[model samples]
Target: MAEFKIVLSDRETGRSYKIDATGPAAGALIGRRIGEEIEGGVLGFAGYRIRITGASDRTGIPARRDLPGPARRRLLLSRGVGFHPVREGERRRKSVRGNEISADIVQVNAVVTQRGSKPLDEYFNRPEAAAE
Candidate 1:
């Protein structure tokens, strides 16, 4: 069975939430590419909508939107998702995962598109229990 750690970003509040998806929720995410939108019910949040923004494989290779499949490839780039430029006209081969999600992906990044009737703070803003 596949497992995924979903990082949901709430742009309005500039806050993020982390949830672990297992069983059916994990299965539903497999094969979904970046930029695709899925219902929040899939992640146990009914009435909310989330859009996949990016994902990373087990080893932390970020999925690039311009790339097509689930395979990892090294591409020469001056500056982009995987590569960062330090000097002028610098380019190097950097490994990056494709846009598609697969079993190898361990983390998925997403942004909330539609909010449910209840505000998100109600869900994630619970106060921490005090330590005795």
Candidate 2:
């Protein structure tokens, strides 16, 4: 199951709460201090939901997935054949450095991790799915 981050803050006392994303209702019960009114609970920077409540018992939370973005892209780029600028007048091009790197990763994983074949498109004519 996916995890979410949650942040709770009291409007009256300025107290704050940070917790891993779970059922908001459950966390609200866990994170709220006794007799305190819940003001807000929201998702934290990594996209986990925050829940504010009136009870307090902050403690261990589970690990969360951190999706790779620009910094990771750069690190990945550096480890393989580098990316190239998209030149004007070019309609299409070779696999991106990331793509190249991914292919390499697939090859390596297949060998070392004993994973199965990385699925490749059997045909290019299929329509792309809209972003959900």
Candidate 3:
């Protein structure tokens, strides 16, 4: 089984979490969107949901091709010329040893959208019930 390290950050709270995934589904998260939701079983639980915010390879290169112009420029400048310049909406691909390597260690940045085996509504029977 191929293992992957997923680093998720809450966009609102700025809190981050590290999760380890081992399976084929984990590998399928490579090119997902920022707000896309994934099953928590990929992390461990069965009923939970994880929302992806950002993703990158192990080396820190982002998997998404929609970075802003300034951010893209900054990344390119920092990584030097070895990395090919990519336009907006264009993914970077490289060939090595007769194989195409896009990303080896995919670092998935996400947020826990849901948790536990029960529905979120079950936790709160009424609006007043959440006040306590």
For all candidates in order, the CA lDDT equals 0.90, 0.25, 0.51
Provide the lDDT at 89 for model 3.
48
lDDT of 2 by residue, 1-132 (tens): 223333444343344434454455334333232222332222222322222121111222111112121112312222212333466443422222121111112111000111113211111122341221
Better of 2 and 3 by TM-score: 3
lDDT of 1 by residue, 1-132 (tens): 999999999998798999899999999999899999999988888899999999998898899999999999989878879888999999998999999999999999999999998766667665551221
If the candidates were sorted by their lDDT against the true structure, best first, what order would they fall in?
1, 3, 2
- Please give the RMSD to the true structure for each candidate, in Å: 3.3, 22.5, 9.8
TM-score for candidate 2:
0.19
Give a tens-digit lDDT track for model 3, residues 1-132: 446677755444455656676666666664445566878666555787878655554555554434422122233232322255556545444321101112354566677777666533333354653563
lDDT of 3: 0.51
> Which one wins on TM-score?
1
Clashes of each: 0, 14, 0
Ranking by TM-score: 1, 3, 2
Better candidate number, 1 or 3, judged by TM-score:
1
